[model samples]
Target: MDKDNDHGKNDGEQRLESGEGDTMRAEGRFIEPQEPRAEPGQSEEQAGTGDHATPERLDHPIIEEPHEKPEKRTTTELLYGVIANPVETLRYVAKHKLVAAGILIYVAVAWIGAFASIPGSLNSFEQIPEISGLPMFSPRSIIVFTIVGTPFFSLLWLVVYAGILHLIASLLKGKGEFPGLVSAVGFASFPMIISTPFSLLDYVMGIGISLYGLISLPFTIWTIVLTIIGVRENYNFSTARAVWTFFIPLIALFLLAILLVIGIIALFVGALSR
Candidate 1:
């Protein structure tokens, strides 16, 4: 009975040891599952959203954008630009004011001198003695000659005025042909023509000289104003400059008048000697 009991106890101890060893071997074989890893150039969000596809490049040549051009002014627009703006007119005059003034002064002096000398010339012809060596022309003949010559002088004056105005316009950087100056002068002459009837009536009356003088004042002022406008239109100068430029010609004319008077005296002396 004792031997059987010892054998039972030994068998129980061996079973216990085997159970512990199996538990340890099972624990060693178990490994934590490896976590899933992401590859390079890929994000967890991209992968989740399924948007990791590469963008494609185009194979054909790229077209460049074309550049835009600037706008240009038209002819009528340029014409208005030349005439309408006073600032532009002044600028034109500032550049060529001296020449313009000189021409104007010459014209003024010539007109004044012509008017002043007319009566003296007529009287001189009337007083010409019908002596031996004198010309056979009578006072009536002389008067007729003078009257005939007036148109020629008038035409000459017109030509000179137009030519000078054109030259001034050219100096001021204006564009156009000579006709521009002619047209301008022609327009300016209108006031002078209108005043003529008044002048004739004044002559018929005893107060003709004073009345004509008053009328001439307005005519002169108008002429000067028109001259400035014409110059501004032709030369593209500002109004102020064109107005200032008038002095140039005025001074020249004053000087020319003095010279003309001296020349007349010298001619008179020479004639007396002859």
Candidate 2:
């Protein structure tokens, strides 16, 4: 009996050592090898929950930003820049309080220059005495009126110019301000100051009004050009609109004047016949 029991134990040991335990499956499939066992009271699946964590993300796209504009200039710089680079100066003047300063400068220059050049314009006037009947326009009275009323004239001009330009610009879908338009018109008048000296030269040196007019014509043209730019810039409109804004009013005034003269003549004829 002892010999038979020893033989059965030996056969069992041989079967285990021959890899029969490895072929055993839990649910009709071979068991996969696993990591070391978890701690006390912890299952392998529960331990894996602690091991899994949120990952870091870094795949977002970059975004861009806009740059800033340049700083503004001073009133003096804008004054000098008017005839030099009118568009830039008008832009500067429109956004600042420089319109007041510009209008003041124009009025002062015009007053003093007119007073200074009386001798020349008077000489020119005396030579053309063919129309002496118009005594209200004597050289002395005209000088007095200009000296006393230059500020008023300048202010009136500013209002009219700014008003017309703002209206036209608004009609054309522009987004300009009235104050800025005033500054633009005021600064556009900067070129007028240039002609003052030449007028004085003609008066003092007696170079003749023709020469003075000839020399000052370019400055007048410059003033007109600057004005056109000012209107264009302040209105933020096309060059064509700016040109029309300037000349239309003047043309209308001329037509009105001709109509008035014709009406007055017709009235006088009717009165004489009656």
Among all candidates shown, the one with the greatest lDDT: 2
What TM value does model 2 have? Answer: 0.64
The residue ranges of model 2 lying beyond 4 angstroms of the native Cα positions read 1-69, 121-147
| Steric collisions counted per model | 16, 0
Each prediction's RMSD to truth: 22.0, 14.0
Candidate 1's displacement at residue 141, Å, is 4.0
lDDT tens per residue, model 2, 1-274 = 9999999778656755886545544344444558666777775544655552223221343455667776767767877788577787787777664667767766776676667677775676677767534675687687777777777886776787678767767777777788777777777777777677777777567687789889989988888888788777776778998888788777978999999999999999999999
In model 2, the clashing pairs are none
Cα lDDT of model 1 by residue, 114-207, tens digit: 4544554444555556532245455455456555665467567767766765665566666644554444444444445445455444334434
Task: Estimate the TM-score of every prediction.
Answer: 0.42, 0.64
Our tally of clashes for model 1 stands at: 16
